[model samples]
Target: MQLFYTPDITDSPIYYLSEEESKHCIRVLRLELADHVQLIDGRGGLYEAEIVDAHPKKVALKLLTRELEYAKRNHYLHIAVAPTKNIERLEWFLEKATEIGIDEITLINCQRSERKEAKAERLNKIITAAIKQSLKAYHPKLNDITPLQKLIAQPFDGQKFIAHCEPGDKQDLSKTLKPNSRYLILIGPEGDFTPKEIEDALQNGFEPITLGNSRLRTETAALEACFEINFLNR
Candidate 1:
């Protein structure tokens, strides 16, 4: 089923697709007047719409039905990771994490981080595309890039964990995470977290966790953490 995104669906039953989306619906999809299409508001609302006007530049639709679907996981998964040096790798992680299941994501600038900033707009687009592609109703939240120290200072009600390579008695992530509970897991950069950074996180009540025996890249480790949380809930 082809799903189109339109976050702003006012109370009115009639809605017009954006210029870009209109072109795709009319020109690419060859949808004609009265053709039924699915629309997602990205806020858990899936609407069934019928094309009223088939204009390629400005297609209009009338809502026929609306269904509210909640997230698949009972608990929320929030992953904070330092952006990788290769921006593409970070983008890849964002896309995959959204497809797998993630509630929120925060990009952090660590002492050893290579990339300090990310395009929030671009990342949101990637997330939107991923949600549509994966047939997910809820849209994941993408937070702005923030400093590691600043992020840990904020209060979180859920369980907190930081995945690092520093040698110590760290529990396995899969075993450490509790099912049906909110989680915020931290994944470090390519160089991993510094001893001082690790200490700071621990002081903030973030437990140290291990991903696995094999060392993974920054993006890979972040995606692994995301997958682990979803897997446990499943």
Candidate 2:
């Protein structure tokens, strides 16, 4: 089934695709009038619709069916990781994490972070594309670049962990994780989190956990954490 993203889709029977989506539907995909297509609101709403007008600029659709909480996961994952030196690597993490099932993401700036900033608009686009490609109903929340200490101070109801290579007693992330729960994990930058930052996180209620013995890059470690959480729930 061809899936299209319509984040603004409402309960109205008649819905019009955005100009960009319309062009893709009518011109690129060559889906003509009466073609059946699927639309996702990125809020757990899946819609089945028939094309009413095949105009490339504003293809119209008649909504036939709607399903809420379609394929919704039983768990919630929120990762706050330091942005990689290469923006592309961070973008790669975002795309893969979305496909792997993540509930939220925050590009954090650590003391040793090489890349302190990110293009939210571009990253969000990548996530949206991944959601459509993966045929997911929910969209992960992408937060603006935040400071490490700031995120560490926030209150989280479920598990809270900090994955770093610092010398200290830590638990294995895979074994430490619990299923069907909300989680917030912190992943350090290329240089890893500083001792003080690690201390700060621990002091702020974030438990120290190790992804594994083999050291991984910033983006790889983040994706590994995402996969671990989703796998545990599965």
Candidate 3:
């Protein structure tokens, strides 16, 4: 079953289907009257509906059921990383990360970060596709590109980590993760985090984490951290 994300769920027995979705439904899928479909709002509301009528520009559905999803686990995974200089790599991370299940992502600007300005609109589209492709109802929240210094100050009530390749006492990301615990992992630029930046993170209560012994690209490190968090939860 194909499910589309719709943030707004109405109870008046009406929904304004987007033109593109309407066209896909009526022309591409050719769904007939009373055909069933699912609509999800990234905020955990899933609506089960049956088609009332199929119009080229307006396909209507009658809400059959609405399910409010509970949190699968107690913890949340938030990955903040510098966007790769190559836009494709950044986009690749976004797609796979969403597929693998991430709670939130922040594009951070670090001293060595090659790419400073990241577009949120394009990333939003990629995330939406990943959510549909992976058959997930929840869409991870995406933050505007922010300075690494500014992002560090954000409230993180649970475990916080900074993934770096520098030699020092650093914990393995997977080993340090706690099941059902909220986590925030910060990844640095291609050149890695500056000494002062690392010091600042530690001072702010972010523990040092190592993805593995091998050196990975900015996007790779971020994706690896994401997978580790999900794996620990599983």
In terms of TM-score, the best-performing candidate is: 2
Question: Model 3: runs farther than 4 Å from truth?
Answer: none
TM-score of each: 0.96, 0.98, 0.95
Better of 2 and 3 by TM-score: 2
Model 1, 1-234: lDDT tens digits are: 468988998668899999999999888988899889988887888888999998898889999998887455698888999998898998999999989999899999999999988889998999999989987878999899889999999999889999999899899866777788989998999899999999999999999999899899999999988888888888
Q: Least lDDT summed over 10 consecutive residues: which range in candidate 3?
A: 66-75
Quantify all predictions' global Cα lDDT against the true fold: 0.89, 0.92, 0.85
Rank order (by TM-score, best first): 2, 1, 3
How accurate locally is residue 55 in candidate 3, as Cα lDDT from 0 to 100? 82
The TM-score measured for candidate 2 stands at 0.98
Residues 71-173, model 3: lDDT tens digits = 3445688999999999999999999999988989999989998998978999999999898787666889999888888888878889999988777999886
Model 1 quality (TM-score): 0.96
Clashes of each: 0, 0, 0
Clashing pairs in 1: none
Higher lDDT: candidate 1 or 2? 2
Clashing pairs in 3: none
